[model samples]
Target: METSSGKKGVWAKIISFDLGATGSKKVKFYRQLFGFHSTRRRGTQTRRVFTPGILSKIPHLVLGKSVVAVPPEACSQLLDFLSNPQWKPIQVHVVDGLLSAEQVRRAVEEFFSRPVRLTGGEVPLSQAVRAVSRRDAGDPDRRFVERLLDQLGRFEWLKEAVRRAKEELSR
Candidate 1:
């Protein structure tokens, strides 16, 4: 999928996988690994909710898809999986937009790990400027903001605004 700029479209889809019957070992393991909590609703129906800090390690199971969505809290586990050389080139899409695309991309690049293309939208220019303005010089996100500014500088329509944002951030 390509947009007007010829960049491949970033698409996201939500899929449900049944881990077997309720209370089974497969179901229990999936719940524990994904940090899913069960709560009873009206009648006997139960709902599963995802919580953070539950995944300690990547499961031995292999995902057939080339892209997988993981929770933000499992960053460590995700990193471990990416660091492993045995797996194929799979792109990781953080399930919730808890982390920015630039942040994830920077982290993956810094670690020299596998390439991970984040799903969803990029940070807006105004938001990027605001973030850079709010952060201190030592902030890690400063580089991302700088890169965004440089890219925006090439567009004639955004050049002036990008220049102003950079000038403000410098002060």
Candidate 2:
């Protein structure tokens, strides 16, 4: 329950980015409830990047977590930065989405309410839980990739980021 200002807790934010044939849509909510929501249009989409910092909207504990959603390159960068051993212990959580930057943000929030399992090797990443089917625990659990792909597909920011990353890597 943390806010951008670093005064309140129970903060909540929701971003829904729609990046499809039409364009991209983004919405942001803060403070446990719907406080801030905005949509920015662009000719092209870009992959969204969320660098959770101490004063980030998300709680401080959420940082340093080895998130499965984190791209490999970003993860590598994170590792290099925090590898000094002076960094704190973080628990990264990975979830699936619509491939929208806004959706990515939503995935992060939804992850809190839903149950997650350990997936990463070292710092146990989080995976969104799935419910049982009619038989019992028969239903296959929902994977993080699903949500992530879904969100990413529509997220203009996310797409753009991916494009940039690919271009940079190509060089």
Candidate achieving the largest lDDT? 1
Where does candidate 2 stray beyond 4 Å? 1-68, 88-157, 160-171
TM-score of 2: 0.20
Cα lDDT tens digits for candidate 1, 121-171: 234345556656867887756766677567546533234556787987887
Look at candidate 1 and give me any clashing residue pairs.
none
Q: Which candidate number would show the highest TM-score if scored against the true structure?
A: 1
Tens-place lDDT per residue, model 2, 103-163, is 4555444433322232321111122222211122222332342343344434332454334
lDDT of 2 at 99: 32
TM-score of each: 0.28, 0.20
